[model samples]
Target chain A: MSLARLSRSQQSNRLPELLVPAALGTLMLIYFAVPFVAFLTRAGTTNIITGLSTPEAQVAIRNSLLTAPISTLIATAFGVPLAYVLARASFVGKRLVEALVILPLIVPPVVGGAMILTAVGRFTPIGSAAATLGISLTDSLIGVILAQTFVAAPFVIITARAGFGAIDERLEQASRSLGYGPLSTFWNVSLPLARGAIIAGIILTFARAIGEFGATMMVAYNPRTMPTRIWVDFIAGGMDAIVPVALALLGITLAVLTAVQRFGRVPTVIDR
Target chain B: MILELKQLTHRYGDELAVDDVSFELEEGELLALLGPSGCGKTTIVQAIAGHVQPTAGRVVLRNRDVTEASPEDRHVGIVFQQPTLYPHMTVSENVAYGLTARGVEPNQRDERVSEYLELVDLTEQWDAYPSELSGGQQRRVEVARALAPQPDVLLLDEPLSALDRQLRERLRKEIARIQTETGVTTLFVTHDQQEAMALADRLIVMNDGRVSGSGTPRALYGSPPTPFVASFLGRSNTFPATVVAQQPPTLRVGTHKLTVSNQELSVSAGTSVTCHIRPDGLSVIAPGSENGTALSLAGEVVTVTDVGRRYDVTIRTERSDEFVVETVERPPEPGEEITLELPRDRITIFETHDHDRGSTTGVPEH
Candidate 1:
């Protein structure tokens, strides 16, 4: 037999041994992907395009695009420092705080929404205080942003913390010895070294924010995002409206997922 | 003139990494802090560089106390054991990192980078990333980076330890040459005694978080104050000697009466002592030769192997004491009875009770 044929036969023999798990994994992928496939197949691209431009759909799209990023930014402002501290510093209750941050990720989105509502709902103590200050959290755009951030911040923290932790402590010490001050060393050495992981974390955080559905539904039903819009179209316009919105949402998420996968690959610096 | 550590004591969670150690560096002199790992050599260098704050001490730079100053404010440059070049930058950019941080004029930064790269003989690798360079080439870039800053003092933390033997030797010589040419007060830390001897004008020997001895490399090697210094600085054959007679400037050793000229010592007669003599100072003689082998001791050659230009011979005496002897001619055959002669003046004497004698008993001066 030719070398190609021999290798192919060899591969074919080994393929059965791997086939069980590989097929199962592919089935798992299909299980999650079939809904998107069906949504796309059931509606034309023009339908999706038109569905996204509808006034209600447009408001949902605008609110999602606007609120998710603001949530991510808010998360970053508090999360980056928190991640650094968790990675580098020793303090009381640090583990507790870290666990608390990851809690939202583990809790169901509806439960997370309920918790937010109980704490900041109009009748609760904090909500009463917020009401005194003329600020509303429940059934508002601000509430949606807060819920997305609450769910999203932990992913950034976990990824950024691991990135910071992976860096050799000696690099910072070396920078300091080379006459760079602590702040300069952090900016020049630590930040650049952790850049890839931080970008990955930001992307992950943004994706989590954009995909947030149940919490947004419960906390801010009035302000509909794409996920909320799809829910509404399913209730109001049946499969005709729902399929197109679902397709649009699926396309946006997939595009974001692909971009994140491309950008989040930690670039190996040649010198290191 | 450049830097000095005064009563430096560095404590890390109650464990003293560096005890009360004090030393000074001249403007252009190369000082090597030589010791095995965990001997507090790095702590001293870090303290002087202002990376570690001594629990109590003064780091005097140009006669000014900079003990509390940060590394940047101290104006000291350091080369870590690993090549810590910025991975994103090329060799030239890595070399210019310090200058760039200092906001040096762009032209000057370029000039300084080129100058240091040339000094390190790495100008050809200027555009190469650190990952693309060989281990030796990367270290050269690290040295170049440290030098480009034009700092008052340079601290090197085992800079050549990562390189292979030939590369380490070559780079060490190159470093000594560069230090001499630049006249930057340099403090280098290394475990290799040969490297310290080859590079430093003065050697600071550390042990267990304390300075054991500090002197010119010649002085420390030639006349080690302590047995640890005598043995650690090089190799020296030490013997158990009794001070049967203590003449004004000399003392006798062993059944064979050998005298060492050490007048300042107040060692009395009949006191037990340890006598050390370097290998080069000892000669293998015929059973009874001229001068009658005055300090001769009988031993059997345990191992004899030719080491290029000379023969590396180990001789074990009746007491199972092994002494390494390097001789130009062929060494005595193994199991052969041999008489080793030690010259009187070259012999070193230490008090038997001296704790440092423990370190030299198993080792002989090279």
Candidate 2:
């Protein structure tokens, strides 16, 4: 009986109703695919080699690789524990905490960078305290790291929170009944269960940090990251200098994203 | 006592989840807390396991006042209704969870894990994850894991409630045998009376967040203390009666007179009460063939239902009361006359009272 229904539903295509939506979907695909195709079509090995030979471009690539990963690591260390807490604990200001964590996702990047500047710029009380500890937050690599961390931390929090929330509470209770304390249970059961989501979050944070523009432009532009360098190159030379560096950044993003998507294929309960 | 609950009163705002409930368990005793939902049976189990702290009283385990202890410190194993096997862990690892938590040597953990898995007859499935097993198989895994630690007490919260009928019946017997072999003081919570009666050494029948009745299966079944007990364990034929005589202990039930044993009737003459007769107490005979030895009711067979091994013949008496007689013999056809003989010794009496859910209808149709 279900087979009959399945075949009937399959037979009824609703082609007339789907035509407009299908056209719109194709239009969107074309819209997204065109620019990337144009960039790739214009580039060659010689241009990439030349772009790589430039000292300023090399420094920018090095700077982005260094700071983006640091931001991602810092985001992970803070966000994962916060996500687990948000998933499991019932605190007085839980909703407020969640809204604050999601602040970077909705607020404009330049605005977030400006807020960070006012709070921890070179002359601010906390900023000088940080400088006294050898950590700078304006026109420096540390400034780039802080801005990227602020903008990208929410990605980790939101994704990891979902992952942690999917786990059954019984699993933790079972661990407790089996004589494990809450901290140990979190390490052994909760962490392993949320491994996939954490990796995915890390990938997204790294990508966002690497490609950061408005915030990095606000906090620090001297020790230029990849995005700032690309902007500089685009202004000085035309699309020629922008092309090769952009492709390099795109390459790194693709590698990490692909690795995350492949490596984070966690065996879900359904796989059991 | 291996376990003791002393005046445990757990409240939720103004409502009582467990109101001054107390009980004691001897070593190796399999006690069942049987009740409908919201009856505090699960609360008592949780309190003993240290998952829930009672608002007022203490839970003593092995003579130790472990009221403020954590679940880890209490060393109690729990098996939930939905078998809570760690899905990521294989069966053997799941069984060895408690031992590993205690930092037991790997060699001993493996041996004990295999032993308990074999105990639940799931040795071959040790390499399988929880979701890979069937409902009954998963339940067996849970039982194995709960037993592996060899805890002082085992708490099962409606463990067999989720299985299909056949699986529940088979696992019921399996759990009883396992409990006997392990000899762990087990306090199992269930809403199913039949399952409770079959598995428990003694049953604690709960109602409204307190113990309403408690006794051995035979004792509670033979002499239910209230209307709830009388019907909960199995079906009972109840009749509203007023005491007519105190000296010889007789009751005027409607127009009929029933002579009950004096000890079963505690109320004075002219006081109203409820008389309970087990369905087995009614013996059907051909009409007008009954002797003067027992109370007789002349009735016509209303329905004859073939219930596998026997037939349930429902007879409607002339007084408009219906009684069901379970018999293996050939039952009379519908509309045929029969005599229902009520044996006086099997009758139980209770003070007239109103049940929250049940009707005041003298006879409840089950």
Candidate 3:
């Protein structure tokens, strides 16, 4: 039989086999799409614009805008090196280190915040020292940052680790043999090769940090983030007040995602 | 000597990978490490490149001990088996990487990159990434990259084995030309005997982690010191034989007797020895042809394989010993009885207990 005819006949024979999965997949897609559609329709542009004009909403927007990027920067600056080490080096307790890196992701965000508090609470030595230096570790922007970093840093580390792991070690070896030192080889070969994945991880970290709620609430409730503000709005004024702030939060997140998608085209080494 | 590995040994945990391997490369000499897969040839290359620290022994370059030095400090250029051209870099950038790392002026680096790219005939591909090139083209880029640094010694770890037969042959010639033009001391590692023999000035045959033999390609091919070298180097018909006479130097292969040169027969009479004869060494004597000083064996044609450029005829003798004979002329069919002639000088004999034997019959796949 001709190839086209054979393929068509085979596809037709498999249609019944695909029916269940296709139906299930479409249902799940709709389930995910429904909330976004409902939120967008209910929180009209006028409501969103008006809600975002409120003093509380403005403060929350300012706090989120300021903290998330800083948190993302911190995560990328520290996490990429950790990821590289985990991927390339073998040392004692390496498995434990890897598991610890993923601990923030595994634990509940409130529990993570509580763990952060127990370690650096006002009564603790680090918190008391910071307080004595006139810097409060909790109930401030620093607290918000700590919470967001705790909740979101794992995304970048895990993704960047996977990216570094995919690189051929021989490429680095080749770099070294060509007279580049280990550090130079890492900068010249490893970093550029894993840039695609690291950028992807950065995007995910920023998204998660911006949307972080439970941990942010547990650590710093006064200097409100978008999620915390939404929670307060839901408690005080119900759905009507919550919609605009929620839409504002969604709008900022979507804008960030869109901007990143447009600009940060992840460059990867072409597979041989 | 440009580079010397003295009694180099490396072990991966409890398993030994390279065992007391020692060799030297004279200035601008092309040496090939020929061996089978997992024979630790690549490990030796790594040791020389300073990528792997040898468990014991020193690597001396230009009379300077460099065994403890890092790869970057060694200034040894290497082309890996896989074309490890930095996929993220353009051809020009890849070629200039080493020079840039060495802090050469940008203008000088560009000049050297263009020079080496042109040497590999990839000047037109300077702007292209490695992924845009063919396998052979990528390998050429790797060679250009390795050569642009002007390293004291160049190590190629089976650089062309990944290509097809036609491309491999073409690149092999190009590599030889490039090496000659650069005049850099080079060590080429390969499992294919043909590639080794065709490219190298001298060959080091390795087996299981040790050097079985080392000599000029022609010398190694004609007179391998060990049975592993004989079977691994080229096509050979090896027979388990016993030395029957000392003065005339004769071996008894089953019921047939074959005489060899006295130079290779160091064992005494009645000692067990392995007889090795290349396919081309044995000939089919026509029924009425004169067999002057050539040992003759009467056998039946078992199989004839028409390999390109020649025909390999497998003949089973009356004593059930099989020997393959290669000839340009068409051979008789299977079951046809024939008389095969063995020239005395073409035979090489080794004491059976001297070294471990590889395959006793049939050609090894490359």
Which one wins on TM-score? 3
User: How many times do residue backbones clash in model 3?
Assistant: 0
Residue A197, model 2: lDDT of 79
Compared with the true structure, model 2 gives a TM-score of 0.89
What is the C-alpha lDDT profile of model 3 across A1-272, one tens digit per residue? 37656676778856566568889999999999998798777766346677789899999999999999999999999999999999999999998998899899999999998888988889999999999999988889999999999999999998889989999998999999988888988899999888878878888899899999988888887699999999998999887888877777777877876677557664321211
Decide which is better by DockQ, 1 or 3.
3
Superposed by TM-score, candidate 2 places the C-alpha of residue A47 at a distance from the truth, in angstroms, of: 0.8
List candidate 1 stretches off by more than 4 Å: A1-46, A91-93, A177-179, A232-241, A254-272, B123-128, B245-254, B267-270, B290-293, B352-366
Considering summed lDDT, which 10 consecutive residues are worst modelled in model 3 chain B?
B356-365
lDDT (Cα, 0-100) at B16 in candidate 2: 88
Question: TM-scores for all candidates?
Answer: 0.87, 0.89, 0.92
RMSD of each: 4.7, 3.9, 3.5
lDDT for position B271 in model 2: 95
Residue B82 C-alpha lDDT in model 1: 70
DockQ for each numbered candidate: 0.54, 0.63, 0.78
Ranked by DockQ, top first: 3, 2, 1
Task: List candidate 3 stretches off by more than 4 Å.
Answer: A1-23, A267-272, B244-250, B253-259, B264-268, B286-292, B354-356, B364-366
Report every candidate's CA lDDT.
0.79, 0.85, 0.87
TM-score (2 decimals) of chain A in model 3: 0.90
